[model samples]
Target: MKKISRRDFLAASAAVGAAGVLTACGGSSSTAASTAGSAAASSAAGGKSTDYPTKGISVICPWSAGGGTDSCLRAFCEAMGKNLGVTLTVDNQTGGGGILGHQAIADANTDGYTIGMITFELATYKKLGTSELTWENYAPLCRVNTDAAAITVGAKWAADNGITDLPGFIDYCKAHPGEVQMGGSSNASVWHIAGGYLMSATGIDIQMITYQEGAATAVQNAAGGFIQGVTVSLAEARSFIESGDLICLGVMDEERNPVFPDVPTCKEQGYDITYYTQRGMAAPLGVDDAIMTRLEEACAAAIEDPDFVTFMNNNGQAISYLDAQGYADYLKQAAVDVAAAMDAVGL
Candidate 1:
C-alpha cells in the first residue's frame, strides 16, 4: 500500500478547506454515497484553504506510545497537519484509563491547537465517577476509527490446551471455571469491557486480571501464560497474529472484519452485546464558533483523504467518520447505552 506523505496530505487538506463552502450546500441533507465520494475527491484536488493551521497543533493521546490509539491517530494527525500546514505532535499523557489525556485537553484553552483523542474512556470514566471529564469536556472534532473487540489468546496456550477456536475455548472455560485468566489493558478499558460482557453472556467465570498497563504488555502477559485470554483492538495484536504468537477467537462486532473474515463476531456466536472502542478528537469546551467550525472542517478533510482511509484500513481500523454534532449525538446515545449495559451487569 502506498502511503501519502504528510506534505501531500496537508496540501490536499487545504484544497478540501476551499471546498468547505460547497460542502455546506450538499451538507443540508446527507448526499448519496456516490455524490459524497465525488465531492470528497474534488475537495482533495481543490487546493489549500486560506483559513487553517497558522501554527503547530498538539494532539494528546491518552495511551502510551505504540498502542492502538497512538498508531491510528499518528497516521491521521500527521495527514491532517500536512493538510492544514502545521505540525501535529502527539503527547502521551497516560494514566487512569485515559483520564490524564482527557483532563489535559479538557483543561487546555480551546485555542484549536490543543486537541486530543477521546475513546470509550470518555464514557467509561464517567460511570466510574473518577473525574468530571465527559464528552461535554471537549469539542467533538471527527471520528477516525472505532474498534469492536477481538478475542485474542496466546499461541502457546492455545496449542497446549487444544483450544483452537472460540467455541472450543469457551467450552474449555466452561469445563474448567476459574482456571482461565483474562487480563485487561485497563480496569474499564474496552478490553475488559468485552470480557465482562462475555462473562455475563456466557456464564463463564473467567478470572479478571487488572493490568492498567498498555495493550501490548497485556497481550504479552496473556501469551506468556500469565493469563489465558485478552480482548483488545485488532491493531494491538496484529503483529502477534501474523507471527502466530496469538489466535483471535472472535471479534466483538456485528459484521466480521474483512481482514479477519474467518473470525466470527460475538453476535454470530449468540452474544447479544456489542461494544466499541473509538478514537476521535475533541477541543476543550467553550471554543469559539469560528475556531470550532475551522477545526471541524479540518477534521472532516482529514477523514476524507484517500491517504487517511488507506492508512486506517491497513492498520486494522474501521472508518467511522462523524462531525462535531454527530459525535455529540453519539455521546448522548452512548451515555444511555453504556448506562444500560452497566446496569445489566450490575456494575
Candidate 2:
C-alpha cells in the first residue's frame, strides 16, 4: 500500500483542525456544555473565594488498580495531597469500559471534594452511545501525560515477511491487503483508533483483532504470534520488545520517546501521523470557582513533584502539561477529532 504523502496528510489534518473532526452527529463540543458552564459559573458568582480542603478528598479512577492510569494517578494524588495538606484517596470505580467511573466523577458533588483522572476514552463515550459523559461534563483541572501508540510486531513475523522497517511493513500490507492482522487494546479504545489511523494514513487494509481484556492481552497475543502486530503504546509492548520477541517498527509521534531512543517515529519514516492517549484531572461540574482554582493549583504543583516525576519517568509515561483553560480547549477539540477517528473505524 502506498503510504500517504506528507502533503496529503497535512491537508486532511487541516480540514479537521489538525487534531481531526467528529461528524456533526456528535454535536459541537467546541464550547463547554452550556448547562455545566453556566451552573459552574453561577455557583461561583456572588461568592467570595473560600478556603478549601478542610478535610480529606477522594479521587475516582476509571481503570483497575495497579494499571498504568491507576499507578500514575496514585503518585500524582500523593503529591497533590502534600500540596493541599489533605489526604487524597483514589477510589477505583471500574466498569462499563470506563463509562461508570467517568460518570461517577461527573455526578459527584460540586463541592470540589471529589475529582477524577479522566482519560482519552472520554471523547468516545457519547459517540459509542455508552454514556452521555464527555469532557464537557467536568471542570478540567490539568492534563497529566500522553502515551504515543506504536507499530510493534513479533520478531518472527517481521523476519519471515522481510519487513525490516515501517516502509517494508507497508509494502507487505499493500501487496497483501486484508491479509495482515493487528491487535488492539479494546474495541473503540485509543489503540483501536490508532489502527484506524494507520489504515487511513497508509490506505491499507488489515484485520484489527480486538481484546476487550485490554492492551496487556493484546501485547501478549502479538508476542505469542497470535497476531501480526499490536498498535498499542510502546510501554504496553515494552516487555516483548525488550525480550527481542517483538520489534517496534515505528511510533506515532512527532519525536522519539525518550524511554526508547532508537525507535524511529512514523514521521521520520515518511509518515506524518501522530496519535496518543491522554490522562488528566478534573472535578464535577458546578464546583465553586475558588475551589476549582485551588484544585488546579494543586494539580500544577503536583505534576512537578519529584516523586511523581520519578514515577512517570520510570513508568515510560511522558508528561504533557496543560493548564485548566488549555485542557478545556483541548477536550473540546479532542471530541471533534475523535469523532472522525470513530468514523474511520466504522464506529
Candidate 3:
C-alpha cells in the first residue's frame, strides 16, 4: 500500500488548481430501477403497519472513510439511526476530493433510502469551473455542523522563529512581510481561504504556496519547515497540537472554541471575519423532495441527540443546525459571498 503523505497529496492540488468536480448522476429512469424493488418490498412491509426502513439506508460519504468528514457523519448516522429506524450504513466513494462519492449519492434513488454528506466542496468545486456540480444540482437536506478554522504555527517553527503568540506572530510578519512562506492545498480550499482572508486583513505579504496534497500534507510541510503557517480546521491538526507539534494562533469564528479555550479568535485578534464552513447532507439534483425532507428531519434529530452532541463536542465541532430550506439559502448566499471574495483577492 502506498502510504501517501499530505505533502504528496497537496502538491497536485496547487498544480492543477482546486476545483469542484461533481454532477447529478441518478435520474428517474436510473433511480427508479435502483429503488423499485426495494420500494415495493418496503411498501409490503409497511402494509402490516410496521415502521420505515424495511430496507437498509445508505449514507454516502464523499471523502475517505476515517477522515474528518467521514468521522463526523458516522457520529450523526449513529444518532439518526434511532430516529430513522434503519441501519444507516456509510459507503465511502472517495475520489476527486469527494466528487466521486458526491456523484454516487447524487445519482442514487431518491426513494428515502439513500443520503449523503455535503461539505465545502459542494460550492467550491463548481466555482473553479471543474464540474457542473453546484448547489443547484443537489437537494440540500440538513447542515450537520459548521467548523471554524484555526490558524496554527508548527511548534518548532514558532520556537525557532521566536514567535510566541498571535500578536507576536503578527509583529514578526509585519517586520518581515513576504519573507514568511505559507502553504495550502489550492485555491478555494479552507486553507487557501483562511490564508487569503488573513493576508488581506493584515496587509501582510506572505508567499502563499498551494499544493495538491491536502491538509495532512500542509501540516507535515509546516512542521518540516516547508511552510511557516497553516490555515486549516482544528480537527485536521488536532493530533499534532496534542503532541506539541503545532501552536494554535487564532480561530476564525465569532468566539474562541470551547475545546481550545486559550486560543483567541480572529475577531479578538482584531480581524473582523467569520469563516464558518458548514458541512452537511445533500442529494443529487432532481432527487425526490419527500425523501430530501425526510433526510433533513433525520439529520435534525441526530444533531440534537445527546450522544451525538457529546461526540461532536468532544471533537471540537460547533453546532450550527440548518434544515433543508435553511441549508439551501445558506448555499446560495455562500456562493455569492465567496465569488465576491475570490474576485476581490484576484484569485
For residues 244-322, write the lDDT of model 1, one tens digit per residue: 8888888867788777778788778766546567777788888666667766777888888887788777777788888
Ten-residue stretch with the least lDDT total in model 1:
22-31
Positional deviation of residue 115's Cα in model 2 after best superposition, in angstroms = 1.4
Model 2 quality (TM-score) = 0.80
Over 1-347, each residue of candidate 3 has an lDDT whose tens digit, in order, gives: 01212222222232211221111111001111111122312222213432345776778876554345666777888787766666677776755655676677778776767778876665666667766676777788877777776778888889987887777888888888667776644445556555665665566656666544345566667767667767777766677787888888888777888888888887787766556556778776765544445566667788898988998888887777878788888878776765555554444
Q: Give per-model TM-scores.
A: 0.82, 0.80, 0.79
Q: What is the lDDT of every predicted structure here?
A: 0.65, 0.73, 0.63
Model 3 lDDT on a 0 to 1 scale: 0.63
How are the candidates ranked when ordered by lDDT, highest leading? 2, 1, 3
Q: State which candidate, 1 or 3, has the greater lDDT.
A: 1
Model 2 misplaced stretches (Cα beyond 4 Å): 1-51, 65-67, 340-345
Instruction: Please state the error at residue 221 of candidate 3 in Å.
Output: 3.5
Q: After superposition, how far is residue 167 of candidate 3 from its true place, in Å?
A: 1.8
lDDT of 1: 0.65
